[model samples]
Target: MCKPLSDAISQGRVSTEEGERKVWAALEAAISHFIEGGLVTDDLMKQLLPRKYEHWELRSRKPRPSLRVFGRFAMPDVFVGTHVERRDRLGAKWSPQWEHQKLVCEDHWNEAGLPAPFTDQPSFLYERYITSNARQKIRVQL
Candidate 1:
């Protein structure tokens, strides 16, 4: 959560901590970009984000500034924007745009019943960069 990122830099002064906090906050901010307009992610991804960027802002060429959410756990990379991205072995960063297209996005409100898709709206990811549940307060554990 933002608190942990803050605590990571709690020892510093306002300006110092501000920068330090950014380092810690970048991943969370990225996941919360709100571009995909919904929050979603796994636990392991959260760990890798701080590791890769050390809290650096997750910028992009397109720079639409979408909400970042989705720690897939498959890759431990910190990504900003709706598309979760990662650095390849050659050190080139690759946005999981395809993966986003396939894995991200919302489904029907009710799995079995007739309900409208919520894709028109945004999704929310909490402080730890964990996506909120379909109904909120519900953790999706695979």
Candidate 2:
């Protein structure tokens, strides 16, 4: 998600500095409205995770007993998705892609007795974005 709101709009062939400045300005301007009354409270189920683009916030649901398990479980957390552009060429398959970097609630889909990358949320979706973005950029350059 290399913040689609940032590079895609401001860099329609403009300087990176100009693009960052404008995007930051817009973000600053919008913060107040977004936080007026919807601020996260202590009681809210909040998961703060780091992503490449914008920060991800997972709003978990009410907890419940697991039907398949003997213990309780929380609901799947939503990946508050975002993207960020690396200042340098990144080593990942995609350097400029909006890589989903954070694991919200759903990230823990791996059963305690199981391993990673094969949870309810497939890890490849995020990785594929990186790969496809790398290929797309290559195509654009070609």
Candidate 3:
């Protein structure tokens, strides 16, 4: 996590303490599941499309005004989060905000001198980086 993102989470920027807790819990759960080699369904984590974004999001959607942690994979099984946002607050005019978030992630990667994200097809990403049974466990609700 970047300083800004960590600060946002720690400072309860998700509007309420409960909201913050939910987001934090979801993030922790997802990370633990990933580390254990469990398949991360799209509902839990999604790679943005068009490939150019090279961005991924860890989503917490159970509560209203779901939270998103914007980041990119630094390598197989490694994600570096850069920003946080509320899904509802992103509004219908979301493309620009989404692009902005992508830019923020890119800047973070550059500042950290991280390697470029893997921007291959979804299948390729799964095959190369994720667990072998990832395809079978995939649930495409995105």
Candidate 4:
């Protein structure tokens, strides 16, 4: 996990205890899924990571994501938690922390000598609760 994420959780980044719990669960789920070599569904994991650091944003203290967790796969089996953000509501608005976390994650990957831009192939957003045999890959804008 990254410093920002730890800091967020320690500092009570979210407004409600429920939100914090959800964020905590999300981070744990991310780590667990990553360790098992699986992709996290968007409902649980949203990719807000940018390709560069210059585009990062400094977030304000309002209208934040309810259960936000940011990270990237530094390697096939290695997932680095770069940052965590949580609020009373999970809005679809763009998050500055998202980019910042991505930048942190990217830096970690670079220092570790891992390849950047983790995937070159197209990404598919999969359903969250569907079983593997019943799951469907839907091509969507990222």
Best by TM-score: 3
Query: On residues 1-88, what C-alpha lDDT tens digit does candidate 1 reach at each position?
Result: 2232233323322445454445335544434553344543332132223233222223221222222332222112223222233222
Error in Å for residue 3 of model 2: 18
For 33-85, candidate 2 gives per-residue lDDT tens digits of 22343333312212222322222322222121100001111222222222222
For model 3, the run of ten residues with the poorest summed lDDT: 129-138
- Predicted structure 3: lDDT: 0.69
Q: How close is candidate 3 to the true structure, as a TM-score?
A: 0.74
**What is the lDDT of every predicted structure here?**
0.30, 0.27, 0.69, 0.46
lDDT of 4 by residue, 1-142 (tens): 6576677666654536876556555555544664564644444434443323212112223223445555554433344565654543434445564434455656654655545534423442323222242223334778
lDDT of candidate 1 at residue 42, scale 0 to 100: 32
Instruction: Compute each candidate's TM-score over C-alphas.
Output: 0.20, 0.21, 0.74, 0.45
Indicate the worst ten consecutive residues by lDDT in candidate 4.
51-60
Candidate 4 regions off by >4 Å? 7-30, 33-39, 49-65, 87-91, 95-117, 121-142
Candidates arranged by lDDT, highest first? 3, 4, 1, 2
Which residue pairs clash in candidate 3? none
